[model samples]
Target: MGTFRIEGGAPLKGEITPQGAKNEALQVLCTVLLTPEKVTITNIPDIIDVNKLIALLSNLGVKVQKLGHGAYSFQADEVNLSYIESEAFKKEGAALRGSIMIVGPLLARFGKGYIPKPGGDKIGRRRLDTHFEGFINLGAKFRYNEEDHFYGVEAERLKGTYMLLDEASVTGTANIVMAAVLAEGKTTIYNAACEPYLQQLCNMLNSMGAKITGVGSNLLEIEGVDSLGGCEHRILPDMIEIGSWIGLAAMTQSEITIKNVSWDNLGVIPSTFRKLGITLERRGDDIYIPAHTEGYEIQSYIDGSILTIADAPWPGFTPDLLSIVLVVATQARGSVLIHQKMFESRLFFTDRLIDMGAQIILCDPHRANVIGLGFKSKLRGILMSSPDIRAGISLLIAALSAKGVSIIQNGDQIDRGYERIDERLKAIGAKITRID
Candidate 1:
C-alpha cells in the first residue's frame, strides 16, 4: 500500500554500501536450527525478506538477537519442534521460498519436518522436487495433500549419496545441502548452484565443522558430520542489488561509488555489462561509476551493430538481474536483445518502458529487443504498477531517468531485497518520495 514518485533525469551520485546478500543471509540464518548454539552473523541485509525470515525463526523458538547494524546472533539452542505444525508456522512457511529450507534441518535434527505451500516471486513454476528427491534418497517418507498443500517429511538418519538434481534451482540446492550436512555419509551434489550465495552457505557450513568442498562450481562434495557447532559467518554482499545500483548509476549519468562489492565473486558480471559499453571501475572492493559515462552500444557482430543480452545459468548472466539490465540498456546508444530463458513473463513488464517513449520490441513472452533511443530522446514518466522485485526496481530506475514525475505503485516490491532503497536513493540526490 505504498508508492514511490521518482522525478526523471538524475543519475544517482554518491556512495552506497551494498547490504548482505538476501539469498545467502536467509540460508545461513536458517542453518541455526542445525545446532543448539548461538550462530553469529554479520553483514545481514535489513530487508523485508530477512526480517520475515527472522520472525519465522523466532516463532519457531529460535532466539534472534540483534547485536548491531547488519549484525545478529541466532541461537536455536532448543528449537520447539511442536511449533513446526502450528498454524502460524504454516502461514510463515507459505510466506517465503526460503522458508522451505527449514524442512531439511528440521528433518535431520528433529526426525520430521512440516511446511505449507511456499510463496515467492510468481515468475513461473518453481518446484521443490530436487529438494524432496534428495531427502528421499537419504530415506525420507513424505506425504502432502494436494488440495490443502501441506507437506510433512519423516526422515531417518539421512545417509549421504550422490544427488543429480533435476535442475540447479538455487533454494533447492541449499535445502539439500543443509540436509546433507548432518547426514551419515558423503553427499555429492551435481548440477548444484554454486553462486556466491551458495558458496557462502558452504562456507558457513564449514565453519560449523561440516566438510564441504568444490564451492562456487556446479558440483559440490559435502561430508556429513555427526553434529555441528555454532560459528560466526559474514554474509556476502548483495551483488544483484550492486548490479542494480550500477545500472541505475549508468542510466542516470550519475557518478556513484558502491562499496564492499566482492570483486572476485563477480565473475563475468562486469564483462556482461561491458558488452553494453558501460565503464566499470574496481577500486579494491569498491565499484565506482563515473559521471556522464557514455553509454555503450549493444553491438551485434564484429561490425558493431545491434546485439542482445540474455540470461543463462551461473557463469552466464544471472537471470534475476536481467530485467534491471534491460531497463538500463534502454538508455544506451544502440539496441540489444534480452532473452530471459528462465522465466516466461519477466519481459512482459517492458511495456511500461515502451510507454516512457523508449523503443522496445516485445517478441513473445521470453524475448525482447530493446533499442536505446539515446538519453536525448527524453522518456516521459507515467503511473505504473510494480510487477516483481527486480522488475519493480527496474521500473523505479526508469522512473528515475524519465522526464516527468512518475508514480510507482507497489513500491514495497522493491523493499524485498534492496534495503532502505528510498533513503539510499535520497542520499544520492534522487528525487524520490515514498507515500503510503
Candidate 2:
C-alpha cells in the first residue's frame, strides 16, 4: 500500500489545470470497441482506473497506441472475443467497476459479452441490474453464474425498444446507449442519466454515424446504424476534481487559479461552493479562488433555516463532491447538513475528520451534520487510511489545512481518480510527498 505524507498549514499558490473527466474517459474508451476504425481520444487523465480499462482493451486485442501525454489511439478491428471467456479476463474485469461497460459494446458488435462481478469503491450496493436489465430489454439473453458471480449476455442481433430506467444510473445509461447504437431499430431511453459525461458519449457516437438526438437531456433517441466509424474526441475537464481544488483552496486559504474549467458544463458546482461562502471568481475560462483570510460562512436559506446541500441527478450537485463539501464545511462559520443521498457509506469518512478536531455528526449512513469550527480550532493531523476515491481526496484536503504532518494510507484510492495529485499539489507549493 502506498502512502502520502503531508505537511499541513501552507497555503498553495499558482495555477492548476483540471484533468480530463475520469468518468467520461471510462465511457468513451469503451466506445472504441464499437468501431473497427481508429478512434483517437485526447485529454485522457493519467489515472489508475482509466489505465486499467485501457489495458483491458489492449488485452482484448484492441490496437492501442500512445499518441502522446493524455492521448491515445485505439482500433478494435481484430478483437479477440475468446479472451472475454478466459480466467485472466475474469480476474482483470472483476477488479475494475468500469469493466462492466465493455460488455455493452462487445455484445453490440460481437454476438456475446461476459463479465465477472465488477469491483470498485465499496461505498454501497451499486447494482449491475440496470445494465443487464437494459440489455435484456433490448432482446439480449442474460445469464448469471451463481458460484463464480459472473454475468453473461448474448444475442444474435439486438432489436431496439423503449426503456424507462429504474434509476438514472450513469454507467447503466452509457452501457445501454452503446448497445442500442448498433441495434436493429430505434431505441428510446426515458428517465436516462443526462450527465455531461453521458452526453459526451452520445455526441461522440453521433459523430461516428449513430443517429442520437436529445444531446443534453434525459430522454435520448437512438436510431441504430449498421456500422460506426472512427472519430477523434476530447474529454471535458473533470468537474469533480475542479470542485476538489476549489475546496482545497478555501480550506488551505490559498489563492489558486484553476485553468480551462469548461465553465458552462460545471452545472451548479460553483454556486454550490459559493453557498458555503467560498469566494471563487470566473476569470474568462478559468476559476480564480482568492485566499479566505477571515474564513468562510455557510449560507442559510431565505427563511434563515440551516442550509442543506444534497445530491441528485444531473443539473444538481454531484454526489462525488459531497465529501469535499463536508470537509470544507468543517472550517466554515456556520453549520450545514450534507445529505449524501446517493451512497450510504460516503459520509462515514467524517469520523476521520472528527478525529482531526472537526465538529461533525454522522447522523446516519446517508447524512451528516457539520458544525464549522470557523478556524478557531485548527485541525491536527493523524494517521488515516483512505476509504474511497472521493473521501481520500477530501481527507487529503483536510490534511493540507491541518497542523503538523498527516499520513494517508492506501493512497492508491485517490490516484485512481486524480491524475498525479501529489506531484500536482507539490508544484503549487503544497508540502506533499508520496511514500511508495
Candidate 3:
C-alpha cells in the first residue's frame, strides 16, 4: 500500500504524451511466445502490471532484453515448460489477469498450457468461462482444479472451427485468436471484440506470418499457420490515459495538450467528452484542451431529456472511461447519467466523490447520476482509498480539482495502469507526492 498527498485547487499546464496502450501491451507481450525468433516491441509502458508480466516471462525462461526506453526484445526459443507448474509460477500467475492470455499462445505452440486462477481488479465478477470455452471449441481438452483454483488446456493439435463468443470480451477474443492462429484450418470468430488494442494484436500477428482478416470488425477470419516468424510491433498511445487527461483538464480548468493520441483509433472518446461540453481542439494528432474558464456544460438529448452515457462493445464509449467521465461531470454546468453496462461495482466509487462534496447519486451498482457544481461550489478534499485502477485515477483527478490537501491510500492501484503518474503530473504543474 502507498499514499498520495495532493495539494488541490491548482490548474495544470504542459504537453504530456500518453504511454503505449496498457491493454495492448499485455496482449502483445503474450504473443511473443508464439514464435522462437526475436520479437522487438517498442512504446511499451513501464507500469507495474506490464513489468510483472515481463518478469513472469523471464521466469519461464524467455530471453528478454531491454533495448532502450520503452523498447524490448523477446525470444521464446528456450522456454522452460515445466517451470509453469511450480509454486512460484502459480503465485505469479495468480496475481495478474493478463497471465490468462499467455495460455493461448503457449497452448498453440507447446500443445499444453496451465495457469493458476488469475486475479486483477475487483470491480465485478469477471469469469474465465469465455477463454476456456473458446479453447474447448478449438479442439482442446480443458480441466480445472477447484481445490487449487488452477486451469489447464491441452491438445495434440488444435483444429480450427467457427465460434460465436458469448460476449465480445477483449481478452477472451485475444486469447482465442492466438490459439486459433496455429490451428489446422480456417477459424472464424463472430461477435469478437474489435477494439483498437485487439486490432493491433491481429495486425502484429499478421506481421508475424499469421493469416488474419477483418482487422477492425467484430467478425474475424484466421488461417492457421504451421509456424510463426518474429516481427517488430509498436503499440498505439494509451487512449484511456488520454481520456483521463481530458477529464483532468476540464475538471481543474487546466490548459493541457495530449500529444500523439492517434485520433482515428480513439473511437467515440473525444466526442463523448464533447457531449459534456468540454472543448477539445484537434491540433494534428494531438488534442489541445483549453482551460474550461467558463466551466463546461453538459448537453441534453434532442427531446430535452437528461443526457445518458453508457458503455458497450468497440466503437462505443469504453467502460474504463466511465469513471473519469462521471468524475468530470461533477464539475460541469449540467447533469448527466453514467451507465456502466459492462461491469458492476465500477460506479461504487462515486461514494468517494460524494464525500469530497460533489453532488452525485449512486443510483445502483452500475449507474450514477451527477449534478454539476459548475465550479460555483468547489469540492473540498478528503481522505479516500482507491478501489481499482480506473477508479483510482478518477479519484486522483477529483482530488486535483478539489480545495485543500487530500490523502489517497492504495496509490499502487493507479501505478499499475499509469506510468510514473506523479512524476508526469508534477511536470504539468501538479502538486502531488508519493509516499511508499
**Using Cα atoms with residue i matched to residue i, what is each candidate's TM-score against the true structure?**
0.97, 0.99, 0.99
**Model 2 Cα shift for residue 349 (angstroms):** 0.9
Residue-level lDDT of model 2, residues 101-174, one tens digit each, is 99999999996999999999989989998999999999999999999899999999999999999999999999
Q: Once model 1 is optimally superposed onto the true structure by TM-score, how far is the C-alpha of residue 402 displaced, in angstroms?
A: 0.4
Tell me each candidate's RMSD, in Å, in order: 1.4, 0.6, 0.6
TM-score of 3: 0.99
Residue range 1-436, candidate 3, lDDT tens digits:
9899999999899999999999999999999999999999999999999999999999999999999999999999999999889999999999998999999999999999999999889999899999999999999999998998989999999999999999999999999999999999999999999999999999999999999999899999999999999999999999999999999999999999999999999999999999999999999999999988999999999999999999999989899999999999999988999999878878888888999999998888888899999999999889999999999999999999999999999999999999999999999999999999
Question: Over all chains combined, what TM-score does candidate 1 have?
Answer: 0.97
Candidate 2 segments exceeding 4 Å error: none
lDDT, model 2 = 0.96
The residue pairs found clashing in candidate 3 are none
C-alpha lDDT values of all predictions: 0.86, 0.96, 0.96
Q: Write the per-residue lDDT of candidate 1 for residues 1-436, one digit (tens) a residue.
A: 7799888887667898898899888888889999998899999998888899899899889998999999999999878888888878878889887789899889888889889989877777677888888888877898897976888889768888997988888888888898989889898999998778888888888989899999988999988899999999988888898899888887888899999899988878888887777788999999888875555566567886567678877777889889988998888888888898988887889889898888889998988888886676878899999988899999998888889899999887889878999998899999999999
lDDT of 3: 0.96
Residue 302 shift from truth in candidate 1, angstroms: 2.3
Indicate whether candidate 1 or candidate 3 has the larger TM-score. 3
Q: Which ten residues in a row have the lowest lDDT in candidate 1?
A: 292-301
What value does the lDDT take at residue 271 in candidate 3?
A: 95
